[model samples]
Target: MNGRKNVVEVLIFKKEVEADPRFNVIGEVSLEDTDMLDHIGEGIDVKLIPI
Candidate 1:
């Protein structure tokens, strides 16, 4: 339990595949309050990395 990570839900869609896939991505992401604001201002795209 000490080393376990949390899980997050993400939607993945492939053009070839008619239906989207719902998957779980596990990890932690750290964003400071100010950094989050900056990301919004800069229009940064964030996606989950499979682990």
Candidate 2:
């Protein structure tokens, strides 16, 4: 692979998921994250399936 941007699709189970009601600021601020990790990795608990 060359030094280029690569896109990887990840599959996460809906079971192991938790979210904070207060940290939901995605709609409030699009693109940039006023929170940490764009609120995607932050304020959320999830596990990716190991390939």
Candidate 3:
């Protein structure tokens, strides 16, 4: 992080998955809010803020 501040920003869309400690999951997105996943492989700037 090099002296930078760490923050957690989240965006919810519409799909859901189980969360486990094996992965560094900062939080959970609701099943009804997984639509944001569709943008995963596309090169785009996504800023997430929880609603």
Output the number of the TM-score-best candidate: 3
State the weakest 10-residue window (summed lDDT) of model 1: 11-20
Candidate numbers, best lDDT first, in rank order: 3, 1, 2
lDDT of 3 by residue, 1-51 (tens): 599877554443244556656556556666676675776653555665667
lDDT on C-alpha atoms for all candidate structures = 0.42, 0.41, 0.57
Q: On residues 1-51, what C-alpha lDDT tens digit does candidate 2 reach at each position?
A: 688976544332223346657444222222343343443553356443433
Best by lDDT: 3
Model 2 segments more than 4 A misplaced: 1-4, 16-51
TM-score per candidate, in order?
0.23, 0.22, 0.37
Candidate 2 global lDDT: 0.41
For every model shown, the clashing-pair count is: 0, 0, 7
- Which portions of model 1 miss their true places by more than 4 Å? 16-51
